[model samples]
Target chain A: MTRLIDVENLTLRFSTDEGMITAVDNVSFSLEAGEVMGLVGESGSGKSVTAKSLMKLNASNASYSDETKITLHLDDGPVNVMDLKTSKDMKVVRGGAISMIFQEPMASFAPAITIGDQMVEQLQIHTDMNSKQAREVSIEMLDRVGISDAAQRFKQYAFELSGGMRQRAMIAMALSTKPKLLIADEPTTALDVTIQAQVIDLMKDLVKEFGMGIIFITHDLGVIAQTADKVAVMYLGRLVEQGAVRDVIRNPAHPYTRGLLAALPQLDDLEKPLVPIPGDIPSPLERPPGCVFNTRCEEKVGDICSAKVPDFTNVTENHRAACHIYTQGSDK
Target chain B: MSDDVLISARDLSVHYPLAKGGLFGPKPVVKAVEGVNLDIAKGSFFGLVGESGSGKTTLGRACLKAAPITRGTVRYTDGDVDYSLTEIDNTQLKDYRTRSQLIFQDPYAALSPRMTVRDIIAEPLEVMGLTNGREETDERVREIAAKCRLNLEHLRRFPHAFSGGQRQRISIARALVSRPRFVVADESVAALDVSIQADVLNLLRDIQQEMGLTFLFISHDLSVVAHVCDHVAVMYLGRLVETAPTKDLFKAPRHPYTKALLSAIPSLDPDDPNKAQKLEGEIPSPTNPPPGCKFQTRCPFAVDKCRVDEPKLEHSSTDHVVACHRWQELME
Candidate 1:
């Protein structure tokens, strides 16, 4: 498989009124063409921030470390995402090679404009398609995404569509660009369960047909299990675990990952009581001295857990976790 | 009503009238909740599951008497008092307010940013006039906060200082501070992370057991409902489609909609083949729902009879009830 994108030591911080708080710390992961990576994390785990950095979509308040490197392999050559400073330069990455669909479709779409116009606009920006060709493509994409009466619905505004239909239209718009990479930030979170199921299936089929790399960001493990080929678990702005979805889910090595799986209400096992991870996630202002997850880690090993951050240790050939238990005596 | 039943609704309906299209044209009405019969047993955790526009939230609010009841009756029967929600007097309604409460979905929006944790929890008590003085209110606040695993020191801090999980706990603490026998948690934990969601769920269960409280847990997440609720009800387009015990419902769902809902939930097991009975098309508009069965538009096994004649709730098993024209045939 060809490498689609590679991220190295991507550290991000926001300059807030309080101070410069780290939102993503030394998080690194790569994706191959046609592969789906599920970036799993709770709120404030920086999964969305990391995904946004790929397209350089973060607000002006955000800052990235000098070591941070994001490389997108286009047909021409590998483009250094960080080097593209201006919006004009960044256009090659954003909407051209990487397209994003947000949780709230309404926010992404203009209320006054018709859905078709917005989709056509996006297509025109990224591609060389004219107004006529863009309109036809948008309608075809809408039909492909299962929106009935596509031509009629295309003329209607975003407010005219139902929640599920609006979501489908957003998906249609994103895929209309035919980007090499798609960053779906909690795409199914806002939709109803039945609609969520439909969207998930649609995305999987799109991946198979387009062979584009997708970064699916969500906190729902059940979703990740079904859609993601590889899963990267994030906690407190850090990547604590990364591996094949099956291995990480079946035999999680990190305490945080294990706690997440245990916390989930499994349909097959209704008898098991949900075990929530102990303690609350620490505030970003008062981040821990050593490991970010040490405060909530149930498998903490004495002073080392609180004094030093553990490196990623292999639990299997492809699965790895950053936990004291996995690398207890290796460093010593 | 049976002695074990805490709250019962018979053919309850809530309809809101829309403005007239033309000066002489008839005003349309949004049938939010219609012909719904439900029974919540004493001290039982009942789950109400449905997608958006399915009227699950409206049903929940109607049970709390928060929404206007256009037709039918909702009766609340505790040990000594039995009040009909549809026509309760001001005195009885005020008294009922202290007997039941609601936990909102969004933690960030639910809690007042200006109020301290203590003040937020105590507000309900003060408004209800359930407490005698500041001392009594503070004591009640501390006690419930402790029950919710909130630090006493944090009580003095504003809601902005706490995380999502902490704020949700505060929401719970405030709901229970009134010491209501019945609580309507409408998508309460839906906003929290999986780990924190588990924490809140466990907290809710523990409090339910300790206080012997009956909970009406409304959510779109079937998995969470499966773990926390003893009884489960499935709703569609403002109508109840299936009602059964949690385990029984999961084990053998009779309604096509219920079966599709269960299968639609992406499995946690990676190897599990995706056999989701994907419900095609979105739910029909509630204002102008299909002539016969509301789910016929999306039901995979929908038949001609389903399109011509609406189905009534029938006993599929001893305690399970399903509203589907072809349930028996589909089961066989």
Candidate 2:
């Protein structure tokens, strides 16, 4: 199992009008080939930011910490993605080794260009394929994604297709380059459930066939539970919990994780009252002194929780959570 | 099950004329809601579930008289007053506005940026002339804001100062300020984070209970629908495909579309082993819907009969209706 991507101590901030606001604080995660890691969080939790950071897609105002490091392990060699200063150097991360699909497929696809043309362009840029070859491969990719009349669809603009088809086309374009990793940023959020199901299944099958690692960023736990091999729970720009999807979901350690699970309206159990974590998520500018989630955490562990950030504590063999409850009386 | 029907919509249809007339003599129409029938019990949290172009939003809007009703009789009877929404005049419509309110989907866009939370909430009361004076308006605003868990100090601030969840709470407060008996929440929690969605949902449920209101909760998320709604109706291509109690619908769905929808929800349990029976193809175009059963194109059990003759909603059991020629056989 080769490491596809490894991000360490990724502290990111933006120079906004309000002040320097930290978006991703000391986050760390790695992806293995053919494994799917689900990044689950609410709005402003920076799940999307973390995914974007992988491809250096954050805006110009964004700043990275000195200790931050992003290593992309490709077939050729390991490349320090964070060190890539030029757009040409960054291209290897963008469409060569990694590809991304956004929530809005319509926004991703050009209204003027046909879906086939865009996919062909992606293939031509990443691979040594000619115009004719790219067109054949694009049509094949379109067909592979369950699109009927692929040739006919090849000539149709994005607006001509339905929402589900547009998403499928987006997926086709993203995967056409045969990248080693895929970052799907809420790819199905805008879609209907039935269509989302089909897309999820398609991505899963594609992962198996392509042997590509995927970082699936979404707020929907059900989608994460079904698709992800591992799950990472984020809150206020920090990774609160990281573990196997089953362990993390079944026996969550972090209070935030517990609160999230409790908040969800689970179909398996309808009798449980939805208990939202009290208090609003504190603004980034007015961030709590210590643990980012201390403002809303129900099980506050005295002054230490408010004084110092809790380090990650192992809950089980493959599960870990950042919480003061697990660190009580531990040596400094 | 009870004869306490607050709203009974019979043969409800909403049609929008196209800008350009079709090749034929008659102008082409977009049948947003075609031949829909529903009975919403008083004080019931009725869920309307559908994907894009399924007409759930249009149906909800029609109930509120926000969308034009081409043909139908929407009988609104709340013990105090009885009026046909479709045939209501200007005065009746104005009165209906006070009794029936709509909570929009986007919290960010729903609130006017220029107005303070207090003013935003009080606007409905003022516009309807429900409040006699400034003190009365303030009193009502403060009361509803408190119910929505908003603080008095917070009410003085603009919506831009609030978070997505907080803004949604404000939206809820604004909608409930007039003390409307019938509330239409169209994807109200869809914009919020998963954790915040639960908070807003709990708030909606609490308000409903406290005020004894009837809610037409329109959404695309089945899991969320299963949680909050007492009775759920499934829509496809502007037609009601199935209707049942929430638990009954999730437990034993009869219609193929209903069953497919239930299965399509990505299960929270990772090792459930129940492979999602993914529906094939996109939902057929609403502009030119498929003949007969709307779901026939994507339904695995679709037959020639399903493609030629539209199936009317038929009862399977008490309070459980399904529209499918082979629902009985499919259930077995």
Candidate 3:
């Protein structure tokens, strides 16, 4: 698999009224063509910030560390995303090379404009397609995403369509540009179980057909398990674990990862009692000194967990976790 | 109806007048919920699952008497009191408020941002005059807050100081503070992260057991429903299609809609084959739903009979009920 994007030592902070809040703390990950990377985290976990950083879409208040590097490898050459300061230069990273589908389809789409018009607008901005060509391509993409009577739907506004159709339309608009990377941020969270299943299937199919790298951001482990080739678990702005989805789900090394899986309501076995992490996630302003998740981690290693941050320990060939337990195990 | 049924509805319908009416023409009605019959056993967690526009929310609101019921009857029966919701006066309605309550989906929007957690939880007790004084209200709020796993100190702080899970707990605390025998939790945990969702689910189950409260748990997620609910009902386009015990519903769903719904949930096991019976179209518009079975438009097994004749709920077993013209034949 060819590398599509690489992020290294990406530390980001937001200057809030309260204080400087660390949103993404020294996170690093890479993606390859046609691969799906699941960035799993709850609110304030910095999963969204990490994904948004690819296109430099963070708020104006956000400040990144000087050592942080984000390199988007296009067909032409590798370009540092952080260096793209102007809108003209950033366009290559924004919708040109990377497209994003948000959780709320209504917000993403222009309610006043026809679905086709907005899609055409996006394609025009990203590609050299004329109005006619853009409309044709938009309708085709809409049909590809499973919208019945695509031609009729092309003339309809976002509100005219159902929630599922609106989401499908948004996906169609995103993929119509033929971008290399697609960042889907909780795309199916607003959808029903059945519609979500459809959308997930459509995304999987699109990935195979387009041969594009996808970053699937969601808190649902089941979605991650089914859709993601690789998984990264985030807790309180830190990447606690990263590995192949199978490995991470089967044998989670990080205590937080284990706790997350345990907390999920298992459909296969209904008798299992849900075990939530003992304590609440600490506020980002009051982030713990050592391991970010130590406040909620079940298998805390006493002083070591709260005193110093643990380095990543390789649990398997491609699986790694940053935890005192794994580090201690390796030392022994 | 069983003696243990705390709430029962027969042919319940909730219709809203649309603004599309002209000066002279008859006002068009948006049948948010139509021809729905349900029975909630005392101290049981009943799950209601459906897609958007499927009327789950409106149905829940109707049970709470929040939505105006246009037709049929709803009965609230406890040990001694038997009040018909449709025939209840102002005094009876006020008393019913103490016997039943609603937990909203969005914690952020549901709780007053300006008020502290204590005041938010205490509002219900004060509004309904459930407590004699501020001290009594505080005592009840503290008791319920503890049951929801909220710290006493945290109650002094505003809702903005808390996370989504904690805020949801506050909402739960507020809902249960009135000591209602029947509670309608409308997608209460949908807004929370999966990890936190489990915590709230466990808390709800624990509280239900302790308080002996019957919950009408409304959600669009099938897995969550299967995990928390003892029995489940499937709704589509303002109609009830199926009702059964959770295990039986999951094991062998008779309605095509139910079967499709079960299959659509992305399984934790990646190897699990995607359901072969993938539903095709979006749910038809509720205002102008196709005459007959609303699910027929998307059902793979839909026939001429299904297209013209609406199917009513029929019992397949002692506890299982389904609405499908060909359920018996299709099951074979």
Identify the candidate with maximal lDDT: 1
**The 10-residue segment with the lowest total lDDT in model 1 chain B:** B18-27
TM-score of each: 0.97, 0.97, 0.96
Total clashes for model 3: 0
> Model 1 compared with the native: what TM-score?
0.97
Q: What is the TM-score of chain B alone in each candidate?
A: 0.97, 0.97, 0.97
Ranking by lDDT: 1, 3, 2
Better of 1 and 2 by DockQ: 1
For B1-332, candidate 1 gives per-residue lDDT tens digits of 13399999999999988765556767788899999999999999999999888999999999999899999999999878999998799999999999999999999999888888889999988998988999999999999999989999999999998788989998999999999999999999888888889989999999999999999999999999999999999999999999999999999999999998888888999889568577888888887888899998888788899899999999988789999988888878
1 against 3, candidate with superior DockQ? 1
| Number of backbone collisions per candidate | 0, 0, 0
Considering only chain B, what TM-score does candidate 1 achieve?
0.97
| lDDT preference between candidates 2 and 3, better one | 3
lDDT of 2 by residue, B43-150 (tens): 899999988888999999999888999997899997778899877888888888889989999988888999999899999888888878999899989999889999
* Worst lDDT 10-window in candidate 2 chain B: B273-282
Judging by DockQ against the true structure, name the best candidate.
1
Would you list the rank order by DockQ, best first?
1, 2, 3
lDDT, candidate 3, B1-332, per-residue tens:
13399889999999999888879978888898899999989889999999888999999999989999999999999988999999999999999999998999998899888999999999988888887888988898889899888999888899998888889999999988989999999999988877788889999999999998899999988888989999999999999999999999989999999888878877787667575678776887777889878888898998999999999999999899999999999988
lDDT of 3 by residue, A148-205 (tens): 9999999999998888999999999899989999999999988877788889989999
Clash pairs of candidate 3?
none
Q: RMSD (Cα, Å) of candidate 1? A: 1.7
